[model samples]
Target: MSAEVRELVRTYLPEFPIQYCKSLVTDTTQFMSIDYGHVIELGDVHYMVYKNEAERRFGLEDPKYWVKRCHELETGKRKILKLEFFETFPVQVGKFRVECYRSPDKESRILDIVRGDSRFMQGITIKDAAGRNVRVLEIVNGRRLDLTVDRIDVEHDVYFREHLPGLLRRYLEAVRAIGMLHRHGERHGDIRRDHLYVEHGTGNLCWIDFDYTFHSYEHPFGLDLFGLGNILVFLVGKANITVQSLEGMGLAERLEGRLSSDDLSIVIPNRIVNLRKIYPYVPEALNRVLMHFSNSAEVFYTTTDELLADLEPCVEALESEYGRKPE
Candidate 1:
């Protein structure tokens, strides 16, 4: 399948080198549902082009829905149906706001939350060269911030120490971004370390991946806080505290056997063990922050503001103690 995808891409884009090809799958379902086309990467740009007969064979609608909607506004009824089939590529307006799904409803919901926020990536609709309506978002040129840290040779203690302050600053900024979302009564339903990015050249921190985000009016704020704490753990520990690791440490089995059904008590202890094993040099102040939020204490932060207040001083203390002097 991958070979076929590569060949198809070569036929269409002969000028560009096919860096890689992956079987594109739809996320709207729990079970894996392969899409009609493969997501191909040529140099730095990526495209999702379907095969010639894919639309017919798969009964897929036009991926470019906004294009037709523009025509509707000009001639026919302006009332666009809220159907799921119209969403296609990332419509490039002023910036690049890529919608991963075909549902306009999801795009509208996400835009309503993050459209104007500087901390979050922004998006807008625009007309393409074919006079079709499309959406675009501000492109983040850098790789995931965690990837940068992960690439660092941890054995070179001096290198790790030199970069620690900058990593800490980015971490704090990420926490603040999440806090801003919470302040607006929203929750970043997915808060993994990969979702936070450090912009290339500018070193600006921004959050991405709002596909799972939703209003948090009635939801507990602890999920985001806990996620933030885990991110901090990843930073200070210098390694991911994954579920597989927890299970290896026998923490998962213990939690399953001992913990109550509703109790969210298993995260912190497992994190502490992993942190100690992989990155025991994690500072006391930062360690406390991770512990406080992930522990089973009832007094976990109710607002990101509270978490930020506690985290800022810790950041300062770490920088003062171990930060390298600027060149």
Candidate 2:
């Protein structure tokens, strides 16, 4: 994949330097995902964001977050720089305004918990020239879970039967990794599908971007639990099938008429929560677990332990029905 990406880069920028080409091996994510552009001077080295075909084709550094793809010139090492981005997002989760904070200090502790664990990104915080802390993480080269699901060629039914069962079982390792964090009194407040990557070398499903956290909360790990639920939905369905997407599937009117706002994801309103209604073949156990997030639920999951307790059996059943678990 790295070779293919570099080959595409060469086709785009024939005059691109060889050194720059080497840097792209680690920094292949579309430039739209970051606050890219210009050479940044941190304390010890300069951080330059790599250019790619998307950047050349669309010509957009359509930057969002303060993350940047960079190389340590002094070391010629690939690194991801999370440069001083902090946000306190106040979300109303029933009675609580779950304040999500993106802090480097908070993330450092999460990193500590997963230290020497291949299932998470490893990084250290360093104070820059003016004394602001900048997170410097080694660029993990691999496939994002979202991209991996997208690339699967089979239909959802085929994917669910042949592929998803194995992934669902493997996904528990990641689920439990978060459980370990929660047990240690920490939460990965930002648990988007893209934040997870399967590493090229280890094939470990590694979690990245832990800086977003809510310090004090009425509901501990509310965001993290919800985020995990969303990922589960994606995996269970083989891809995220929103209420809007159902129209294209020719099931829109039939399913939409039956759905209420309660049936939608509590966190993301348009995302379908009761997936089994659309894809009836979804295991009853898994569907029931997913339905917990809908507005129809009486009890909500507050811990990964509880989530895993219910989830483990459903996956075990899937493995039983689908064949042996992946070795």
Candidate 3:
């Protein structure tokens, strides 16, 4: 987290101020996952490789494709940089060899570019091939609270009755995070379990990985709202629930047994059902929130606001039911 420590950690990467020589250019056809990263050596000097022929052969040039590149930095530990981008003009231009270009200054400029992008995520250290300072962000580690629906044995209502409040809190946080991005006209294109990192200690939900974070896009809020709904269902152990299953399962019996069904079509694929099948006893007010999101009619909230609204009552219900605040 410190600057000295960060620089020391980056030494394994190609040292700063290095640029591609003209001769380095090749067909680049075989390089599938093309990258413009620098190769660092122990001498504290940097070497620029335009393309990895092997990677090209395997079709890595595409950006959305994720592949890990590991090399021993000066610290002897392998620093892993996940090449996550598509093959395109930017990559091609970046691959263009540049020897005469000022590597140090270029690195600085790239750093500036990175800093200017609000979509960029924090925590990891970035540097140019020459290993010049890019930008270092504050550490924000995501929490892991994975509760897959298939993993729970309790009936839906029982689980919802018991855990809905806490789950709602996390859901609200996710909605708010989405709203924050929406306010800036950005969208977390991919909002999955892996992308969301919750800070259990702080009751905070942090978004991670900006490789697919989108800017300059409208309607991102709607997409994000759908994603939040999916996530909320996931938390409540209904991510995998099906309409047929809900149909066959009696809502009265389900509520008696503590189960609630999710009917949000956006959250899943083609389904309409009530929460009762999963958790029959869920508070009517809370159930309405779930129903609205499930139906995509909760208009007052951007996905984030809806998420919190749905969750707050549940949190209060949880506290009153358990005699303690649910985490």
Candidate 4:
């Protein structure tokens, strides 16, 4: 079965040398071996060549056909009955892994945005054997800030203090990246700790996932700033207190029980309490900035530049005090 799939891959992409091939198995019954087929890697590129049975069942022979079907569904022109059968394969191009989109138009737009900005994950479009327009993006080799913070020893004051300067610097860089996006008249509608990546070795920060980004003509950018504040809270407090976490904690129920029925101001003071409780080591100056921005009513920073300006002084002070001097 593996050999057969390898032959299929070679037939489709004969130019590249096949480096490795592995059969993807779904189940093994007592009498039958249900092999989903082989995912073959040719040089730096990977392709999932489905078995004959799987191809007949899923109609995945022509990638573009399914992509067009998705477009019809999205535009309300068609309704899909069985959506579970759909699956996507990842391909590698150069240094990045490519996610092929069904809609050539959507893929083209994404590629344009990525190519126009260096802050975004680099991407390109290529036509597959079936002439399907596929989008491939460079895989970011770094850890998300949220995951990175979880691994830090925040409980140890000295250890955390020593590393705080570098963390603050990276945080500033992340903010600056967002500011750059705004200057280009784009808004990253979705900004979270996981979306911001600190590149390995270089320590350069890059933003990923632009599925929700859109052009905003408005000058005041608060939503992204609000996200930046949440990121700061994560960095300084070493805690993941997001809207999802709040929802899980029954924040709505608590607010209903405590606040007056007529009072429109729905303030959550306990958020600050939790930050201070979890990270007692957070400096007072930094804490003030976090609290001010995190509070929706404060209106402390209308733009990313203002937030960066306010944050720079605090970060610089921390670097001077705790940063290791060059030997």
TM-score, each model? 0.57, 0.81, 0.55, 0.57
Q: What digit string (tens of lDDT, one per residue) describes model 1 on residues 1-327?
A: 476556645665454346644453222221123223444232233345332211111245534222111112112222111112342443221122323234444444565677776567665543323333233345556667677677877453554467767777767777787776667655675577777777777677778655443333333565566677667767765665554565775667654454331222234343342243334566666655665644344456667788778888877876787774431
True lDDT of residue 128, candidate 2: 64
Q: What are the lDDT scores of the predictions, listed in order?
A: 0.51, 0.73, 0.45, 0.51
- Best of the two (1, 3) by TM-score: 1
Number of the top-ranking candidate, with lDDT as the measure: 2
Q: RMSD for each model, in Å, please?
A: 12.4, 7.4, 11.5, 13.0
Q: Which stretches of candidate 2 lie over 4 Å from their true place?
A: 1-62, 325-327
Return the lDDT, model 2, position 261.
77
Cα lDDT over the full model 4: 0.51
Summarize candidate 4's per-residue lDDT along 59-170 as a digit string, tens digits.
Answer: 2353222211111111222211111112345433112243422233443455576575555666555544444344445556777666666676645465456766787787
List of clashing residue pairs for candidate 2: none
Number of the top candidate by TM-score?
2
Q: lDDT tens string, model 2, 34-115?
A: 3333344555455555532121112345444456666565566788776665667787654456766778788878777787
In candidate 3 the C-alpha lDDT for residue 26 amounts to 20
Provide the clash count, candidate 1.
12
What's the true lDDT of residue 74 in model 4?
15
